[model samples]
Target: AVMDFACPGLMGDLTSFRKIYAAPIGKAGERGASEEEKRIGAARRAELGRLTQGFIHARKADEINASLLPPKTEYVVFIRLTPTQEDMYIRALKQKSLQSMLGRCGKSDAEAPTSVLGVIQNLQKLCNAASLVEASDEFDIDASSKL
Candidate 1:
């Protein structure tokens, strides 16, 4: 007998689980899945459920142990961009390279997916710190609005 505890949300889709488990289940309803493949995948899923003894949801665990748990508090603070950071951000958005990568103009197909991802990463870095986007060795802590 096997017992497994998993959060349904974290488990993701069955296809993702199958990939992680390296199971022989074929893609179902995907672009390349034939009728036979779909049938095989469905059969395997059914068999998996049948073989499992039972399923349980410990939904009340937190409620039952409420006294032992500390109260949770969440705070969201908004910070405005620094003058230099704001200028850099506006310039970056207007750049032809970023525009091309985002498929807004120029030859978008000429750029690889990795290139597009790199641009996005750089933009995220820019949001954190202008120095990060510049890849400068000297980081001015005061320049970071979030800091």
Candidate 2:
């Protein structure tokens, strides 16, 4: 399993990680690491080993009890688009050119690649969420199911 926490030398491979990260930090400190630092490092390494072994044991226990595990369930939620949002989506499909879909904000020439890209980007943003494409204060976060 991948560990998401960012604490250096805090995983099962504590000694190796400490030798790479912690030891360097200790050496970089004003007077370098003293006996106290060594003691702390050893204590931390032992603690990590205990925790890692415990996690392994727990996972093994779970595997042994797999026959008693509950069946997994998946959920799907449906949301309807608001009337105004639906109108905007339909109007977006009927636009004749890139310049039109960009509204009055984009000033790129109609035939320019930037204008074409802007239209595509706008469509993508709309499909993902209206709030992502719309800069107006009235844009709602609830406008898209992906949110």
Candidate 3:
């Protein structure tokens, strides 16, 4: 199963985020900002023509010079999609049935491959197991209680 999510500001993977936002030398490590520092945290990024950018609003851009090229602070955003959501689309295609159908079609033996028949058997097994697994995960399902 494949799942995907995009957070524009926080695109890409873990390694890249650290590389782009890591503090330079002589900076204090893991140090919370002072009260004066707290005042500085209000800045946000904005585009400023072709050559430059600002992390503060245009109104505040004059105060936040481009010389502050080394960013003063960093923040991160993360997103995740769980296994079921990832699998939902593929699962909708009736994957097990299709697999069995293909397995049967692929057999070239004169008698046809005996293992192709196993595809249907295995598909049934998978469904049975999945139903049991779903039963375990859901208390509201009455079927689980009987077993």
* 1 against 2, candidate with superior TM-score: 1
Summarize candidate 1's per-residue lDDT along 12-130 as a digit string, tens digits: 46666676332535476467888887777777677655544356434577786787778877999877778878899899999987776677434555555778778778878887778
Error of 1 at 121 (Å): 4.9
Stretches of candidate 3 off by over 4 Å are 1-107, 110-112, 131-147
**How should the candidates be ordered by lDDT, best one leading?**
1, 2, 3
Error of 1 at 90 (Å): 3.1
Please list the residue runs of candidate 2 whose C-alpha ends up more than 4 Å from where it truly belongs after superposition: 1-85, 99-110, 139-147
Ranking by TM-score: 1, 2, 3
On residues 21-98, what C-alpha lDDT tens digit does candidate 3 reach at each position?
Answer: 232211223366564433333221111121132322345674666556665687775433234423533473467755
- The TM-scores of all predictions, comma-separated, are 0.50, 0.30, 0.20
How far in Å is the alpha carbon of 9 misplaced in model 2? 33
Question: What local lDDT score does residue 136 receive in model 1, on the 0 to 100 scale?
Answer: 79
Against the true structure, what is every candidate's RMSD? Answer: 8.8, 12.7, 23.0
Worst 10 residues of 3 by lDDT: 42-51
Tens digits of lDDT, candidate 2, 1-147: 244254434454757667754564455453656776666666765665675673444457667667787876799877666665576778887877643545644455555666667777877677556666668887455664555
TM-score for candidate 3, please give it: 0.20
